[model samples]
Target: MDKPTRLIEFESMLFTRHTIPFNARKWGAERELDRSAYVLLSRIQIDGPLSISQLSQAFGLDVSTLNRQTAAMLRAGVVERIPDPEGGVARKFSITTEGERRLDADRARSIRSLERVMADWTPDEVAQFAGFLNRFNRDIERLEGRPWPRP
Candidate 1:
């Protein structure tokens, strides 16, 4: 049998190959969403409003890149800048109702896709898969010092 470490590496690569297309798919062909908006909305939805600086720290992205993404999100009407509820000097991005609607729709679609993929798996198997994936994500976050807020 292959070493567990080697097997995991190969499986992860295969997983990315299948899932990356969810983002890397043909652009402009689908009205669903771009990955940036989905991720940003998800982050904000989970953690509340975030300043560009806060988002940078959260995602390890530079301010300029976030500016561009947030600009697109603004034009898309998915997010709005609001005075920090905590009265911080910097403005923070908050998801609009439209953003919540879009995020919910996309998440539901993703969940349905996963359901089909795991249809044959028993409930215990699904639960175990979720537990393992969560642990894997937490370890990566711990090593990177960029823990994501979970809801």
Candidate 2:
């Protein structure tokens, strides 16, 4: 097959595979956080506090959209706005302890789900798949000039 044709196939498979977990109704029911909240909480936990403007830039979302999202998170007690730790005047959002607990629980559930799905796979196969996914994400981040902070 031509490279272009193979790339198209890959894209289709990617989208299809990505939806599997989301389509799992049982898993979805177990989630306390929605997609946007989970992503925002994870980012805050990893990158430290961030202003709405910063998050907007990072996610390519508009400030108003982020404002609504953050407002919801605030009401849920998942995040709190505080003065920027870097001595900036603008307030920044930080994940609350509740947010951390929720995120951690969700992460554990995701890992367990993945483990169950890959139960038949060899350990090396699982490791290799994870490595490839990480590499793919890093390459995309590099191209976008938005490298995520690594632990």
Clashing pairs in 1: none
Clashing pairs in 2: none
lDDT of 2 at 119: 92
Error of 2 at 50 (Å): 0.6
Q: In candidate 1, what are the lDDT values of residues 26-140, reduced to their tens digit?
A: 2212335688899999999999999999999999999999999999999999999999999889999999999999888777767766776789999999999999999999999
Q: Model 1: runs farther than 4 Å from truth? A: 20-31
Candidates' TM-scores?
0.91, 0.87
lDDT of each: 0.86, 0.85
Candidate 2: how large is its RMSD?
Answer: 2.4
Task: Work out candidate 1's RMSD over C-alphas.
Answer: 3.0
TM-score for candidate 2, residues paired by index: 0.87
Candidate 1 lDDT score at position 147: 96
